[model samples]
Target: MDIIPQIRAAMHTLLSTTTEAIAAAQQYVKRPDRAKFTPSTLVQTLVYGWLAQPTATVEQLAQMACRIGVDVSPQAIDQRFTLATADLLRQLVLASIQPVIAANPVALPILQRFASVRVHDSTSIGLPDALTSTWRGCGNATTGGGSTLKCGVQLDVLTGTITALVPTITGWN
Candidate 1:
């Protein structure tokens, strides 16, 4: 199987979901009355936009929206950032994460010697004191309260595929 078609199929699977299903699942849009940007479009815009440029600005994302056949302003896109949007994006990311198994694996003698080569790593990120209630962290001397989150990923080097993603919130003692 060609990798291009496989990738296209994966993308289509991710973006082909109905807006009604996403709205009901994520509760993103309550009333779709005369709404120009649907939940699907929003997710599509962000997914493709960020995939094209991970550090894309709101204006660039708006351009991506235009490419996807929606005309939304940068400010309009910026205003859409809320708790609901955050939750929706988070859920979409978690749902879209699947192991990528290529038909042709990497051609490396050392890597091929093993049946499978897996790697794992994790990182902890500090959060603002205001979010301590939600994501408690080990106390800090400066603010006396802090929050942190640990994120980890497992990957198969030979297949160049991500196997798992884990996110854990730290709690204060």
Candidate 2:
């Protein structure tokens, strides 16, 4: 099966076609009503930028945005690292992977001994000080105050399914 076309079509639908869906997914109370940084543009910039360079800087991401037809400064990109943007990105990720389903099953005596094999992992992401109100972090003399978001996930390997995507926990303070 040629999956290249399928990948292209999926990307097109996610990044450019479904305008209303993107807007609805990114809805936040304080989100400014402006065209400068649409949800799709932000999603494209981060997704492709990180894929191109895993450890990309804000300037690099801004350049990626430019390549995708949006002109903005690195500071503008930096300012976009907010709670709302995080939520939007999370929602997009869930939406993107929700359709995936493993077709073939692996044959293994040890694996078949159990009903399902589950894996769990968690990580914490530091955020700007402005987000302290939403995601409080450890306070120290050097940084005064900060914020972070703790994300955790659980996947069942037997059927290739994600059982949990918990992002409610805040930083350990």
Candidate 3:
């Protein structure tokens, strides 16, 4: 089935609203010294690139931005992907979830038997020794002796949306 039209429609509906909410939140203050791209533009570009190609590289993202009339270097684009960027993207994802579910309801016959279906998974990433104090490691048992960051995500299978995402130090649990 053709999905491009649907994707475009969803983007049209959500992008501006999400961008406005993000701007109002003031999550990322624009620094006068380095204000090449607005949060909205960066968010839109990243979303588009991800949707178009999940494994797109920083260079590809930079090219995509250029195609859309924004001249930016791959390094600049990469630098923009900080913890703050992740938080902002997560917020945007959470915000668009309801609308996404509403637009694309689950129709699989096998899934109809359940009132709700959810899935959960976690991933751990090893961090540098410097981050040990900030994000405690899992000790000698897991990551040898370095800090580790673990993140868990709960997905609503029926709606094909993420219900929650929790990030914590590996030593927490």
> Best candidate per TM-score, number?
1
Give the residue spans of candidate 3 off by over 4 A. Answer: 1-7, 32-34, 103-173
lDDT value, residue 74 of candidate 2: 95
Model 3 per-residue lDDT tens digits across residues 1-173: 78788777877767766765775696585674667677777877797877788889999898878876678999989998776787787677667665554335578899989977887899878877767765566676568867886778777778777777677666432
lDDT by residue for model 1 (1-101), tens: 45788777776766657333655776777677966798888888988899999989999999999999999999989988876886676665555666233
After superposition on all CA atoms, what RMSD does each candidate show versus the true structure?
A: 5.6, 5.4, 5.6
Which stretches of model 2 miss by more than 4 angstroms?
17-22, 25-33, 105-173
For model 2, residues 55-171, the per-residue Cα lDDT tens digits are: 899999999999999999999999988767776766666565534423344566789888988889987666776667665666544345566556787777777777777775354
Model 1 misplaced regions, further than 4 Å: 18-20, 99-121, 125-149, 154-164, 169-173
Residue 150 of candidate 1: its Cα lDDT? Answer: 70
Clashes of each: 0, 0, 0
Give the TM-score (vs. native) of candidate 3: 0.57
Candidates ranked by TM-score: 1, 2, 3
Better of 1 and 3 by lDDT: 1
Q: What's the TM for model 1? A: 0.63
Worst 10 residues of 3 by lDDT: 96-105
